[model samples]
Target: MIQHFFLLLSIQFRSFFGAVANEWENNRLKLIAGAVTLLVMAGAFFFMFRGLFRYLASLDADLFGFGTALASRLFGMALLAFGVFVGVSSLITGNSALYRSERSTLLMAMPVRRSSLAASSVLQSWFNAGWTMLLMGYPILIAFAEGLEFTTVYLSRGLLLYPLLLLVWLSAGTLLTVLLGWAGGPSGWKLFGGIALIAGCGAVVFFAGGTSSDLIIQEAPGMQLGGLQNFVSDLPGQSRGYWPHSLFLQAMVKGNGNAALILTVEAVVLAAAALTAASWKFLEAWNRSAVAEVRYRSPMFFKDGGRYSTVFQKDLLMFMRDPVQWSQLGLLTGMFAIYVINLGRFPMDFTNPYWLAVGVFINISFSAFAVATMMVRFAFPAPSMEAPGLHVLIQLPRGRELFYGSKWSQTLFLSVIPASILAWFSTMSIGAGPLLQVESVGCIFITAFTLSTINISTGCLFMRKEAGSAVSISSGQGGIISAFASVGFVLFMVGVLSWVTKKYMTDNFTELMLAKPVRDSILYLMLPVGFTVSIASFRAGIKNLRERVF
Candidate 1:
């Protein structure tokens, strides 16, 4: 069994490397785009972390001289957050690999042990989820080391312990996925459980916010080590009963070797336990999943509607059919809620127009980046996601209208509406002027519409059947190009807004509110640019679809 597992693992590794080699040989552009995207992301993460560490290290004036302690706490919170994220990702990817894939079926029919199959799947899931975490994480650690002047030994220890942390998370997630499959859990129950989990997290964060905010609000010396720990713990780690973050912090940053050893042991034990149990129960889980009834039915939302309406309903139903999509959307929503609530909690004066402008800028920047990323993840693969049914779709009369219109409708509901609402609430939370609030929401709508057109256009132009899933499709060359292009547009928009605001808006809220002429000028510049880009992108994408796809 061990040998077979090793062979399976080797095969997985070869498959990954071989795919990379094939892309490098046949589609070098994809390899280059991916490399450029990775470097840009790494650089961004490094700078962001460096800035955060510097701020935490300089928290003496306001945070009561607990700079170092707060920095350590921040480190722990980052690790815990990443761990949880990877775990959730693992559950989604692992479940699919273990039961939903045809390759798994072929493997199960062979003479190999089911244990080997399960073990291989677990390892595969770890690699899939862990690589991103590693790429994003190491840069932060590097920045932390540089910002805090930590020894190289400390950085090395952190690098070593990070994979151990990922192992624990990946194993736990895989175990949960397998356990659910073995228990023959209904899809409804799984959905409900995820909802309950997210809700419970919100409740904990809500309760913790009061206590943590009080420490800062009072301007007491208690806002030192204990207070900082409370803030970090309540937000990420302790909220989920996760302590490895503390262990990693103590071991790596504080030079506590015992904590490091303990974490290592925990990772090993959890991983071994997960592998043994999953392998032992693999047959039963396979049987359970295989025997599960297919209960899907035609969605009746637009059963009797027109062709465009039917396409819209089909897109909506496809999104709803995937539990992973709902879970991810729920997670994004939860994060945004936390972010808006935190904006309200930020210890900054809102009455001053300067501070208000700064807040608005930050809010808009965050929202724009998020919108761009979500577009890449969810919108960039809309056309490719239809690859399996391309033949049927192309045969329809007025197919171009049906396809593009359906995508536009999906973007309106899924991306534009949500982004507009988020912008409205976030700007309101920061107490921006009424005009500024309206402008912010309008900007978000324009941004969302533009990004959706760009990404959906790229999806059509670069539709690939072999990608097989939205996740895979979104990692392609077109997706990378779309992501970068969308982000660059957002940066340009923000720059224009900032320049206009600084050049025209006055220091007082009333003066800024009365600056209608300046606001109108800014809108005139932005609106035309946004519409031009959207129109151009739509035309290009439609041309590609008509020539190649249709």
Candidate 2:
């Protein structure tokens, strides 16, 4: 049994490594970019922790007597919350690669006992949890105890208990995954679960912070430390009595021999029991409930042979039927709502050029993100979505042109309209001169044109062998390409706008600076040039698509 567990772990590790390595090989530049980002994160973490430790060391033991307890509790909750958040996201996302794979299926069919398989899966999950905890939580724990003069017993307990907290997280995640998988149709339920999970997490943070604040108010009245120190010192207890996190923290702080022994035993027992139950029931339940089917039907044909309206309507229907398409749009809607609320909070004087520029930039950022996401998830996948039907499409009369036109029309309608609306709202709210407003709108259209063109061109050029699952983050390289293209386009647009604005100011400094009409006129002239270039890019993309053999 032990050998079997180890074998399974080895296989899973190899599989994970291979998948990641392949992704890197195919998209080396993106992978390098991701690595650089991770490096920056590590550097930031190190500096943050070092500063925290130095600050803690400078405090007097008498004045900072309460600091130890406060820090421990805050660290514990952070660990707990991080664990829970990851667990919840995994559950909603469906650990198909880990849990619903051929290897797992074959292993289940073997003579291997359920206990061994469960143990192995639980261990894998725990390792994942630990990596996550180390990345985000360990710094806080290490910094909190730095220069505090803790005993070896306390240090040992802290070390031991960190993994145990991670195990608790793994247990929670495994249990939730099993339950959600058993429920079936993860796509339908995941949205609901994800929203609920995010909302629940926000509520937990709010209440926990509020409770801690109340506690500090009651206990340490009128204490006036600096803002950062005060925030750290006044945090709530890590957990209530007997809570897993609290027990772990207690072992770390007090380090009583008996307490350590009891917590260790309790953690092991709980983890073992959960794993056993999940293993015994999960596979059977999943097998029974995993198969979810979606049905699609073509629309009824009209008497006039449907004509142009028929083809457009068919494409529209197909778009509506796709869960991925709708989901992307739904996410965009949520993002837009958030952006509007944030915009309302900006302290902007409508007449100020600085405010106007800021508002225009924000709108551009929002539109760019939205359009990029749409293009990658929808436009780039357009060819693959047609699948075997693509052969029939090529054979139809003027099939190539119709095919390209339909996709282009869909992309335009989907990307341009909402982006224009957002740009208009931003410009009007900022009270920019008419010319500047027109220029802003033109900038948005230019951005959309460039992004949409890149999306289609890439979709035609780099066709995937299979229709990748929508939920997987690293499923397609096209998304990374889209992201890169969008960023590049935005930067280019910013440069051009800046140059044009600077040139106008240089030519007519006093009038451009003080007169709205002059500023508006300059912007209006720039708009047409920007619009023309964007249209040229769109045509170039279409030509590229026509030339490609795909």
Q: Which candidate should be chosen as best, given TM-score against the real structure?
A: 1
Which is the leading candidate under lDDT? Answer: 1
lDDT of 2 by residue, 1-550 (tens): 6787787778778988998899788978867876675565566565676565445445435444454444454565565566565554344333453355555578777887665776676666556445645565555566556635442226656776776665655555556666555566344545346435543553464345423342232235665444334445434344444545666666776665565666677667767765666567666655654465556667675435634565677777876665445654665566565565456445454354544555665565666666666667667777556644666776778676777677777787778877777777766665656666666677777677667767665665555546554433223455555556666666666766666565445654332453453344335643554456556655755675567565
Q: 389 in model 2: Cα distance from truth in Å?
A: 4.1
Per-residue C-alpha lDDT of model 1 across residues 1-550, encoded as one tens digit per residue: 8899899988888988999999899989878877998998899889988888877767655655356555655676677678777777677677778877787999977998888988888777778768888888999988888767533338889889988988887777777777778777324458436434634543553445223432232256533344334554344321223356667766777677888898899899989988787788788787887787646787567768988787777777787787666667766777777887778666666665766777887888888888898889888888888877877877889787678768867876788987898899889987776777877887788888888888888888888866476776776567777887898889877876676466535544454543563466346767788889889989998888788733
TM-scores of all models?
0.85, 0.60
Candidate 1 Cα outliers beyond 4 Å, as residue runs: 51-77, 150-153, 185-242, 334-359, 429-431, 500-506, 509-514, 517-521
Q: What lDDT score belongs to each candidate, Candidate 1 first?
A: 0.74, 0.58
Clashes of each: 0, 1
Model 2 C-alpha lDDT versus the unseen true structure: 0.58
Error of 2 at 67 (Å): 26
**Model 1: clashing residue pairs?**
none
Return the lDDT, model 1, position 45.
84
